[model samples]
Target: MTQRRRGDLLVIGGSEKKDSDEERAILRQAARKALEEDGGRIVVLTVASMEPEPLAEIYQKAFGRLGVRQMEVLDIRNREQAYEPANVEKLAGASVLFFTGGDQLRITSQMGGSPLLERIFALHEEGAAIVGTSAGAAAMSETMLIGGPTNRSCLSTLAMAPGLGLLKGVIVDSHFTERGRFARLMGAVAQNPHNLGIGIDEDTAVLVSENDEELTVLGSGAVYVIDGRGIRFTSLSERHPERILTVHDARVHVLGRGDRYNLKERRPIVPSLERV
Candidate 1:
């Protein structure tokens, strides 16, 4: 059987520095990958935001400053727009599909089961890079964290829904430390112990390699990996909605820039100081 080829995915936490002249490493990496094919054509999807144009414009200038000459913005506002032929055509031949920060639910609701999303899946399988930030990043996982209390995790406190499922085996939470969402993420993993929970800090990102088995940390902040496979117990069914979540033996790994992780092995890979 022939296997499908998939592109790299950059799942970024919210609030990446856009106006800085120092170095836009994340955006630069995105632009460079897009330019490697299809004449550097990039399609920015602002479907997650209520005000899509403003967000789209921000990326336009950011990518433009990075020497990306060809770019298009698809501000898909509703389910109807997602099925439009014009919108579907915009994705054709694009080398990158970028999702901006906003409500992750908006992304799944509008684009789910639509032709536009199907086309995007096709593009990804054909080597087009899939990039998402903030809520966009959260929606990339199989399960999404919709809403919950920030500082604490309790049974029935978190609201979760099915995500876009472009990436799987994990649940993602963005702006993790800045917004105090650690507890909520822990609750999620406690409920679903088989799936890993990833909490990403602002300006940070986890780049899933093309093989889909590894992740490389990018940007200045940290990435928290919550492993529940070793979890011995969770008090989800035994506790009330507001009761604090209790999970025993859950392993946590904090990774910094240049750190690499093996998703399949569920372990962190130490970086070598020597240059390759």
Candidate 2:
């Protein structure tokens, strides 16, 4: 088993509202935490998006509105740019590193095994807060859901790929409910029963702890955690690619805003209400 590292993660499910409404304050909360941790300094990585500058500017304005004055956008286009010492050095002394939404595969393929990625990992291990929205969120885990069948099926082929590995022992799927991706996530869990499948709905997030033991849900939508540890059997590998999959004994837990979960324990923790 791989040892989990220490770091805070703000994994947004994607399509998070970035306005001033308190009802839609998920991104604001993340920005506030990042500002508090690193004295308002933030590094935004746009490696996932094809149009890096535009995406970076969007976040720049978003975080800027949240009072993050010192924000630098690292527009690393390719693997060659990832190897640049100056580009890699952009992560140094940053209190927070934020990844924008786009193609998760682009992130892993371009930055994987690069010195820049190592620096990002080092900073994360050193207590810097890492934030990802949408594809960025999906790429945080060790096992990532790339592409899969939209319809429910026992024989559906769900593609899996290596991610940033910021969080381990789990797989994350974004735009879960809105996109009707429950079957896809279920297929992923059926294929790899040892790992947990987390399906996060749009406008929500799972705030993961540094120890990787706990996570708290934020935003209006829900977070679904599928645990396959109790799974008795699965015919995902044996069945033909066109056949429906068969899975048994997979436990699932649904969490809403303000709900907390114990990741290591594979259970939900009831929140305590204290009166002031």
**Tens-digit per-residue lDDT, 1-276, candidate 1:** 966579889999989877785658888777767767658699999989998888888999999888888999999888999999988998888889999999999999999999999999998988889999998999998999999887654565579999999778899999999999888888898888888999999988999984799999889899999999899987776447667677899899999888999998989997786833
The global C-alpha lDDT for each of the candidates, from Candidate 1 onward, is 0.88, 0.85
Lowest summed lDDT window (length 10), candidate 1 = 149-158
Q: What is the RMSD, in Å, between candidate 2 and the native fold over all Cα?
A: 3.4
Measured by TM-score, the strongest candidate is 1
- Write the residue-wise lDDT of candidate 2 on 127-205 in tens digits: 7789998889999989899888664443657778999988888999999999888888988888778889999999999
TM-score of 1: 0.95
Q: Work out how many backbone clashes candidate 1 has.
A: 0
For model 2 the local lDDT of residue 217 reads 92
- TM-scores for every predicted model: 0.95, 0.93
Highest lDDT: give the candidate number.
1
In TM-score terms, candidate 2 sits at 0.93
